[model samples]
Target chain A: MSGLQPCEILVVDDNPGDVRLIQESLKDGRVPNRIHAARDGEEALAFLRRQAPFESAPRPDLILLDLNMPKVGGLEVLRAIKASPEWKTIPTVILTTSMGNGDIKGCYEAQANAYLVKPTDLGTFSEMLSSIQSFWLTLATLPVG
Target chain B: MTQTPAPAISPITLHLLLGDLPGLATCLLGGGGQVLEWTEGAHALLGQGREEAVGRPIADLLRIPAESPLPLLGQRAETWSLLTRRDGSTFRAQLITLPVPEGHLLLMHPALGTPQPKEETVRELMELRQALDESAIVAITDAKGDITYANDRFCRISQYSREELLGKNHRIINSGYHPKAFFTNLWSSIARGHVWRGEIKNRAKDGSYYWVDTTIVPFLDASGRPWQYMSIRFEITERKRVEEALLEKQAELEERAAALARSNADLEQFAYVASHDLQEPLRMVSSFTELLAKRYKGRLDTDADEFIDFAMQGALRMQVMIQDLLAYARLSNTMEGTQRIHLEDALDAALANLSLAVKEAAPTIRRFPLPVVMGDLSHLTLLYQNLLANALKFRHPGRPLELTLGAEREGGHWRCSVKDNGIGFDPQYAERIFTIFQRLHSRAEYPGNGIGLAFCKKIVERHGGRIWVESTPNQGTTFLFTLPMDRSPS
Candidate 1:
């Protein structure tokens, strides 16, 4: 059942409610997948570097980041992720409330794969989540390990 | 020879007896010197019948003062005195006594108050006449309106000497501002016994114009018919000059206002042409790049593919900028027509249009009640689309996104704010970010051509408002802007 080792995704956020929502949205109404959440950017980076307890963690195939958090921010995470050749190949998509010109430009400039604004309405959120599954999980052809 | 009983006492007899008479007199004096006969007027003065008093003497009835002219009449041939009569009243009398055929003759004439006509009174009246001639603005014309005499003031005010004015007609000072018919009518009206009084503008001897308050009076002969006219005038040149200057300034201001209006219209037209002309070439460049990029993906090397992609993005950016510029130009030139735009509805439409990115980020947003603004639905739709997309796109990587939308009242209108926890920028570039084609981030940093914020700025400005941002790097951004409820106050 692990077709191509179900694409690994790293979700970074401090808010439990949003992390749960994103986890539920990404669980595959279309493609079956396992989801992991990091409460902050630092923990998310630790997971990506496979250090300590996360030494057995699989390399993430994609990252969904929140811009606001306690320890390190999403822009910093994007920068660190894109800087290291070990993790640079993994796609990073900015998933946050920010629609600022500087924020959008900053994340993409730090080499994020995509940028997305949060929809306030529920129906739209569900639709967007489903479409994300369709586009990234189905349409986008990533290099297979 | 009963001697006609001698006409009792005639004026000649009264004149002979009142020695106080100036020229002649006669008196009848008896032994006691009682005044006997007076002139016929002396009968009026003495009140004694001549027959009765003829035999009496003067001393029995009248008395003389200690220092008296009546006695002096004997020492000096004639005397003047205040004489006391029988009634005890005084009279200013000149007495002369001359013996007549009848008896000792005396003449008395009482003199009352009679002012002597002095020569200086006549001389002073003549001086007054000369003073009026000097002080008043005066001129005398003959029966035909020709100048017969002009005083010094008349010549000075008219800028003409007496030599030049004398014998010349009133037309010498004519300014010609009035119609010739005006003067002809004036003369004809006055010649028919009417006095003509009017203010006039007259040319001076040096060819400068002067105004005057003038009155011309006609003098009549003994036959009660007009024989001459006298005109008096005072100069009013300064007042006339002020009036002319005020008129000239008013005319100049009117001309300037008309010219300024024309230039403003020309500027509007130029804006229209410039933006419209740019759109055609922009479309060609963008479309050709996309064609090359699409058709040549595998054939191009890494650098070539990258170059082609950058070129296509640039062309596409140019196309969007041009479209926004054209829209901005039209917004200003066209008159504003508005429909109420529902905030939630427009916000929903914006999200619907932005579903692709929303899915990619999988963000969570919070919004409350919103305000409806007066705007064209199309522009408002685009405005919401751009703002929503921006909020979704600037999210943090590896984080769950949270966005908030809200509205508040500011400066007589509603301000919609989009607050996000995205990667924020420096606040110094807030004003510059709204300028056309002004971008804070490079194409490598952001996917947009930097036209979205500029478009939003234009929409807000056209609605008579302002837009700005507050941000710090790595922190969230709050985009605050206002839109007028209506173009004009409701």
Candidate 2:
């Protein structure tokens, strides 16, 4: 605990239930983390840019972006993040309900860190979130923020 | 009655009158039937000189039969008599005698039985010409292609009088619709003395267009060179108009069919997008209900627990049904990854996917050699997996499971079969089973969303094939499908 730093994670999704479930799943993970929720891609971009309401926000160490949402879509947000020199180092993983080959291929081609289909089973879903947290936050060497 | 003093008949005036009666033999005979004067026609018909023919007894020159005697003077008479020529040969003649003041005037027309008289032949020719002129648009052109004659029907159709058409070639009515090559070919054929037939579009005098079906016959002379050409034509403008209208309608129908196909494709795309989007909310419902059941199952009251359980089950089932609907829609939307693959490889992959069920069922499996086919490998794999899964799901509990997979070459395709000793359904439901969400058994008996067979049907059809099942209740089931053979050589 003394050596570890709190990991900041931004979750972009339209459904509040999914955000809450993801938060609950990662509550007891190996890495201590603070989760921020953005209801849409526009808000997610705004938060990443630290504009207005998010002026004092910390740069997220990782992002869990959903493919389908209101306003801008996850792919556009990913491209915007990757294109910006400041936010390009942030590891953005796509988490969505789609298992279509087109969506999978599109996310990878957009340089997503990882693409994961939202599992239907609650236990499997929680395990997936836990693994993502342990691997991206604790194990993988992400850029220092 | 002095007959107006009876103008003295001069020989020159009399000769001029007799010469005007061409193709007839005439002479003046005395009251005693003696030849008094003979015209050139008489000399020509009797093969004798006028000098010798005159002053001869008419009965000696003409062998007049006694039964058909000449009438009395001042009365005209006609009879068929035998005439003697200067050559001493006798021939039949139609003889007519007219009474005159001084003598009888005889007119003779040589008549041969098989060859008609000149007057009759001329009359028959006139009748034939009238019939042809009335029925057809007829025209005669000399070898130089200048119109020599135009019938009334031809003049009416061309809107030209005989004066305007004669000496004019067919170019006056040419519509310029046909290419130069068309006329060139026509002239070449007719010049060679061959009959030419074709449909021609001609322009009228009023600048209107007309179509004619024309046939041209060439008359060849002794040397086999065409001397003249006669063309017979029929008006076919109405038929050509009908044909053009039919062609236009056919083009319009083809355009409409293409538009319909485009609209149908758009609808299919919409269906795919709608079904795909439906799965998102369904996942939230299923995952949350499952989470609720997991987190607070024992902590809640029995009623609450039961309600949560029911919600969980309903959400889970709905999720699966939506996914199945998405897969069905996607089958039409995506048709990539087509390749030549071995059927045995596809079957082996399906067996590997069902490894757990296979181990549990412990079924005896038999496989025969399969042919290489053209298809999407993943789709074919899913097709086989679904069929085998159905067999395992509906296995008869009373007997050990036995399954067989085999294929046979059938013309341009391979007919493959999967036979299973299972709890077969009623034969009536054989067709219904391939429809989505159509189930014969309740969920308690067979746990399925009733999508496997439907998936198999879609996959089979996507590869340009057909799938059907044959089954008998309490007996066994056999599923047969056909796939087109690969066209590429090995």
Q: What's the CA RMSD for each of the models?
A: 28.6, 12.8
- Residue-level lDDT tens digits of model 1 in B1-490: 4664454565445545454554333466532456555554555465545664555655444444444525423322566555545455444566666543344456665543422224476468568757867666778897788898998888887789999998899789888899988888878867766788877898889998888777787876545567788777766678767887889988888888788767856765676677665654454455456556666887979998999888876776665666566666666555357767677787788888888988988877899788777876666667778877777878767568888888887778988888888888888887887776777777677777677887787777666678888877777788887876644444
Error of 2 at B384 (Å): 3.0
Could you tell me how far off, in angstroms, the CA of residue B57 lies in candidate 1 after the best superposition? 48
What are the per-model numbers of colliding residue pairs? Answer: 48, 0
TM-score, chain B, model 1, is 0.42
Model 2 ranges off by over 4 Å? A1-5, A72-76, A79-86, A98-112, B1-267, B333-342, B364-369, B372-374, B408-412, B485-490
Instruction: Tell me candidate 1's interface RMSD.
Output: 17.9
State the DockQ of every prediction.
Answer: 0.01, 0.53
Local distance difference test scores for all models: 0.71, 0.86
lDDT, residue B405, candidate 1: 87
Q: Please give, for residues B1-490, the per-residue lDDT of candidate 2 as tens digits.
A: 4555654885446644985586788888888888888888887777777777678777866666564565545678887666667755566677788777767888788764324336566678779889988888999998988998899988888898899998898789999999999999999999999999999999988888999999999988646889789999999999999999999999999999899879967866776777667766777787788878878998989999999989988888887787777777777666676689999999999999999999999999999998899998888999999999999989999999999999999989999999999989889988999989999999998899999998899889879899999998888999999999999977
lDDT top scorer? 2
In terms of docking quality, model 2 is medium
